[model samples]
Target: MDISLWDQLQSMDKPQTTLNNSVDRVSDEAIERYARSKWLRHKVDDYIKDDKFRRKSVEAFHADLQKLSNNDAKSLLHVSNILDNRSLENIGLDSGDYRNLLITYLQSRQDPLSTYRELILYKIHNVLPEEYLGWFKDDLRCSLFLAYLVKDSIFINAYKGREELISVVTDYLRYEIHMFIEEYTQNLPAYKVDYKGVGEHKTVDILYAKSVYLKNRSKEKDLKWLDSSNQHQIDWTYNYLNEEKRSYIILEDIFFPQTKEEKYELIIASLDILSNVEGTDVESLAILKKRKGDTKIISRGNSERIDVIQRMKKAWVQLGTDTKNSKDKLVLNITNKNKEKLVALAKNVNQTPNKFINQAIEDVHREVFKIDG
Candidate 1:
């Protein structure tokens, strides 16, 4: 909250904020601009360090803003006018940058068309109500910081009223944060996958962008980056949970089927403990573009004529009884006479009957080498 910005809001007499009539609230645009100009990056290091100066700065800010009445929209937007040498960029309000802490703190004005006025009439007038106000004293610079308290609370919405305004502030915050990160660079790797243990017991894990992490020290392991469009993903991270061993992981963003009936079978086949996948709801069958010959599939989820779907199910059943694989492991406890339908159901969508039989083998091949259907 720049004191000058606060001063501009005071003149609007927005809704509530007002100060004691006894206090001298001066709308001296030149003086407020002069104060803002003094706290450039080089000057900021000193003000935040000194207690007396910080207090004096904020109080002076409050006083200067208190000057103008609620008819100062013109002055509020054109802060550049009062100061001859300072530009908006020169008035930095970055996370950990305290130049405009006072102004950003002001948020929406009580009488916004005017200055940094307090609500004299409201039941919650005077000092910032404890519940509504929060303060952060952090050195960890992040985009979240850039948007609101540190930047603009306009980006994140904890509730409905706050939620609606999030995008407006978030866009501005994104540009500012990106510029900040570019300026103060920290090279972080995106989307990593690590494997641990052996065979069926081995697990593949996932992570988003982690600001705080460590590298695997053991020379035996190397990082594999799986990049599509999103680079900010953290694919691998050291897991302290299992012990001293570091782990590699991959992010698999698979949306789950929405209907309970639809989800029960497909989700079971697709997800496993070691498979790094996530999901929320069901996917309606896609309006699939064809591979030209697959014109029948375009009509319905069911395969027609000789019934490709029915044949695939029959194949899976034969294979499950004869072959040993992961999917078969899931059905192990089910009495053979009880879940014949589920077994048949899984078989039906197993990508054709021969494919249904060789499915686990194909998965094995994929793990050994990067192959996709």
Candidate 2:
């Protein structure tokens, strides 16, 4: 007799009989297993009746399957069969494809379209087994799947539209270009040139030039806050300098300005914005303009030749003064090995160790607070 039917018979009112003994002899483990099987079947039936619940059940199963280890082969095979029956190929993935695709996607930086496709495949793979296994409730599973679809669509459309993609790519490239410029400027050779006809011309590194220009052109109130707009302008200036011809001329002028001033002027003229925050040197602009009309005036040994160096020195002093007056100081006890490292880094950037330390503190403060001065 069927175990459930026997169980039912035992529950019915009846006189004591030998059959009762057989019913009572059934193992507790078997009865428990039967009860669990019935409960699971009922849940599955209910899930099938509701379209929304059915979809969620499948999504939950796939999510759980992603987190499973190799030890879960039996469960994995079961889920695979359900997915296969539901025509998994329609979404361009099969039972065994999800894990490998996800792993590849994580490791690769392929084009946006391919990445979006991989993401969609991963989300939609193997939906039926989860439903049968009751892995996630209807609402949560639907929500997670819907959310993934929406996000994936945005990325897909962004790529197709091109404008958004260009903007994102430009921002990323801008950051990389700015970083290279910063390093390049900080480590420029401090070479001096003495032309036979022209008086001695002192070379000003890019960072020093920028700092001096920013200080002299802007008011104290303007310099008090280096906000997002200021930072964007700074980034744009660095990116502009990253152009091959512009960078070459700038470096040549820094080393041999007496001979290369014309080339430098041409590069500087390419810059579109010339406001205070953009750090355009008005004196340099005026000199260049005058030289355009009569080259001999600029070619002659003029006091303006040394003005940039003097401005740079003044900027350094201002930085030190501001750091000293603005805040309380903290003393740190560091190991000699670390001290040696710091000293080496300071030397590389032509900074005193104390000034380097202050610069590092300021950098950290900006990172933590998202504010700058």
Candidate 3:
């Protein structure tokens, strides 16, 4: 069985040694050619040959490596080994070019841990070029870094002068948070079919009630772009968790339905009541024009009229029945203060103002236009 170079590199205790062995097997001419490259020679003399600088750099690198998660540490080691094994002919470039290639590779991979390390190096030691800043700007890694900062701001304390960096990157962080909330909510199960015979109605109802409460709370709060502050991030996280919890509860309710059909019927009936109330409003009559159809009135040129008709249609559909056509039509123009009173009445009944007015009209029609069946 042939193991790939990457697997071997991952398993090896001393990856650098393994890479050096591979280099040794290559022709000395290739090695001498690489050694004589002016860019490589100058880099080695300026940085690698300086004992104090070299020692400090190594120490810093190892210290940072220790701070990474296990998987991240392993990935960084593998990438380092790959760079170390690049031959003069394979790389065919100067030291600065090689460095650029390495940085590009790390950023393209969007390896958060590696990018964070590069950020530390560039911002603190000045070993890397300013162009390497792109690593921190990448969307996914930037969110990861923001998460880290939220967890422990001390990690980047060395670059206190660059607070502007957080401001620049936090938009992506907000976008990520939005996406997470949407994804979590959308994936929740909408109905449950498994608890037909079991006594799960109460459990399901409790869960759904809790979910509805949390979802309503989230709706009440502003969910748009937030300021790039630790407090804002923390608030966003709390809201996100509430959204997630709500979704989970909804999923549970869906997977264990109890009298769901009856519940739906009650909901539809309540909505029908609200719709009837809206239909009787003077505003509704004023906005609707006489039409030759079973629905009686058609919306005039007003967009609000059209919207109301659409909502009425939806409510009728939910009621599982159609309304009778009325040939008679009436138009009324009420005072603005009366309309405000109508709105207040609707709110008190947990219905739209238009809906309450329509229901009142229906009540008056029944009393005035009584016809024996």
Candidate 4:
């Protein structure tokens, strides 16, 4: 519905006399007078109930009303005589201030498209499974984050043109909304609802309105709410994740928990390994967000994995195992005292006993045979 400036000003002339002292609402009289359609009237009603639009618009309208000309004061006085002056006063308006009040009231009505965009994005952030959000938000950055949020190949295939990217995001929004409403609200056999319901303020009508709005508005400013940047750190994150993509599909997978204790154990284990790696500075190269019991590990460094993998290779060689070739373990009976001595020697040289003993035996054998000479 396109309301011209002429229409907006013309509608303001009509009087809105209805009042409810108990709660703030746009009366049916005002709805019928201004909305001009049954569907829009229902949307207007829901819009008032919606905390986002109502609270914001009302607060803004009050502030703007104070700045409007005093010419409306006489009109406010006339309205006070016809309606509950106390209610008008409570809302910070004189009775004849009806024109601006009605205009503001109608303005508070949501554009179903914008409402849908907001709700779908909200659902993505708050209601969808955390795994999906984590995958898109944690790993993917820049416009790539928005691209992955769609979970479709279209944006990538299309070379991510601005309009094409927007279309993909909008398509995803509608798809998710349909799936959520069908699975949670409409499909009674599939989903068992508690007495309180899956969502309280988030009713089917509200969701449906938002979906309709999203479809209508996707081409316009639907994506304006999305941050200009992908809300991720710029430094090292992209390079690191890209480089380690094959080994670590998602960084969060490293911190996944079998139990709470195991989750913490993984964090400690990573820290222990990374901390002990020689010839590399893990702390300077990586950012690990660990505080006591918290299990989250955000690796925003490029060379952290490189350092860790190198250390693991060194450990395997020290254990008498070749990473590239299969090697059978060699066990020999040795006196406890000599074994202890070998362990001490290995510790002093920062080598495993297996590595130290093998090197010592080779050196003695070479000397006895004069192998090099």
Candidate 5:
């Protein structure tokens, strides 16, 4: 994948970031006037690159943003595209040139309010957390980052705006913490899956062993990003986890189910592996108990649990079924025997039934609609 706009900025050496304590020092009226002029593009590059300018501009934007009602803030942040066609004409442009082009597009517009709104977006893009910069591709992350900046300040809970912001922020943190926990849990011996070998069975597969070792090494590198001094991020994570008696296992947001029943199925599928851990117990597993009261899932025999859990985790990570993407559900009516075979085949390859079926359909479609190269 191509490096995103914000990720490029984050790669800079000693790009200074500071909280502007006073908004009055940064003049929004003057910015708007300059932005309205045609000559604005000439100064855009210098202003954006200057750390002091960005700090003051961001502070002024922060003040302006809080004054608006929730609906207005939402509207201002809802941009159709980050860069216009003219700005994107040269894909080979370096990060600095790209940033210059984007700011020029934002300020080149005729409507001052529209230009200001675009500029606020530009400011937010500049101030994103460096640790999670790569994950800033979506609007959800952008909104969450903005909320983190201003969440402590007053917002009308009567409008449910504050409540909504907190809910989303918590949900995001839940998934983040869950990944942290996975780093340890995935290394447990009980989590290992018995692979259905192609050629011959062996006591140990050298390649698989090496892969596991490499994976653990990568996890150690990822853990370094988890060490953060940002108080807002630390507080949000601590408060959310503390709210529950036992920590709730939140599915990654992309793969989170739309219905309660699907969520229950996912939790049930994961429990057999979770339960085998040495210190795990009913009191320790809050989400499973809440979703399904049956204690049997926890104590169930490890007959096929490893395969199920592996398949679920792989499918969950592979699928990006966010509501933002348009999709159509296909209902297939098949005989029981065929369905059993399908399920068995999917499990062997560590895929969900839906994903397996979709892949099969796509394979056939590509063959039927073959194009000569």
Candidate 6:
């Protein structure tokens, strides 16, 4: 609902009260007045939780409120929770800037098409698995702002002479928004809570959000909140599994315990959502985020590699392509000293006794792979 006329009026009038005495929040009176409108109620609920529209950003919010005196401003203020103190502080939040933002948000909200567009984009921001956010945020943000600009110029105050131009702007905004949504949040469920009687708050979940997938040249995907399932695996799927469009995938668990379960549920959901896949094939394709100690090893870099091929890469480069700094060893003393392995190597390689013997001595040079300061 485009800030109701009443909401616009209420926004102009700042309630003498504040949110938990910290941020600007909808006052009880305003809540009571607009209680009948479930949409506005939900908007208020979103505002309360929106750290960006947190009480601290109220100064910026207040600028918007100031535009339309106590009544109009109050209504907007009731709905103006667009940012919180943290974002405000981080971005050097000032009432003046927030006032401008209010104008921005309100201008976007004025039209039905733009309002839905903003809401859908907001949903995309929240919906895409957090793992993809860091790589895609700039694209998403720029898409959002550009969409807003197009709407602001072409539709909000549209004129006749620019009909063709408006159509082009409209087409571009539509195409961009569609692409942004498709790239990140596509083929997945909405970022919403269906309320199956579960409540969780991982004050620590945010800490685990930053993630990177190994094995593939793919970029790191930010692991979001701990689902009742695998966030890590969901992240893995986004960066590695999904991109390949692979028919099957195996994900190893990193954060065990709670995250393990969450990762599992998420991968299962993606499997179900991505295709008509079912039964053991679907089940088998997805990696069962296990609790074994080995699962956590994915997060660690080198030092743990033990594959024969991999070992050669790091430990015995001479066996592969790193034979540069080796020294020819001294001749092996074989007159009387008993050597069973040398005898076996000579027989296996089918080389002369002296040649095999010389090779063994050369191997002892222990080729140096790194240079010292």
Clashes of each: 50, 4, 12, 7, 0, 38
**Candidate 1, run of 10 with poorest lDDT:** 199-208
Point out where model 2 deviates above 4 Å. Answer: 1-165, 168-272, 275-373
Better candidate by lDDT, 2 or 5: 5
For model 3 the local lDDT of residue 65 reads 33
Per-candidate TM-scores read 0.17, 0.15, 0.18, 0.20, 0.21, 0.22
Model 4 RMSD in Å is 21.1
lDDT string for model 1 (13-52, tens) is 3333243322222225433332223223223333335443
Could you tell me the lDDT of residue 258 within candidate 2? 24
Structural RMSD, model 5: 24.6
List runs of model 3 lying over 4 Å from the truth: 1-126, 129-131, 138-150, 153-364, 371-373
Deviation in Å, model 5, residue 172 alpha carbon:
14
- Give a tens-digit lDDT track for model 3, residues 1-373: 8764233333444323332332222223332333123332333344333433322322232333334433223223333443456322323233344444443444344332334334333222212122322434443223222323232222232221123334333422222222333232222212111121222322232233224322322211222322223343333333332254322111112111123332222222112112121243455543332221123444344332223335433653443342232224355798999988888999999999767888987888888899342
What C-alpha lDDT, on a 0 to 100 scale, does residue 368 get in candidate 6?
Answer: 52
- What TM-score would candidate 4 get against the native? 0.20
lDDT (10s digit) by residue, model 6, range 39-59: 444555566456444324334
**RMSD in Å for candidate 6, one decimal?**
18.3
Task: Tell me the deviation in Å of residue 325 in model 1.
Answer: 21
The lowest-lDDT stretch of 10 consecutive residues in candidate 2 is: 194-203
Give per-model CA RMSD. 23.3, 28.6, 23.8, 21.1, 24.6, 18.3
On lDDT, the stronger of 1 and 3 is 3
Query: For each candidate, what is the lDDT?
Result: 0.29, 0.35, 0.34, 0.36, 0.37, 0.34
Candidate 5 Cα outliers beyond 4 Å, as residue runs: 1-93, 111-114, 117-298, 303-373
Q: Tens digits of per-residue lDDT for model 4 on 1-373?
A: 8774334433453224223321344334442322122343455456546654433323333443444333232233223332333333423345445555544433443442243233323433323232223222322121232333222323334332333333333333332433344333221111011122234432442343323222221122322322223323211222232355333222232122333333222222222222221222445323222222222334344234345444433543454345334445566999999989989999999999989989989999999999993
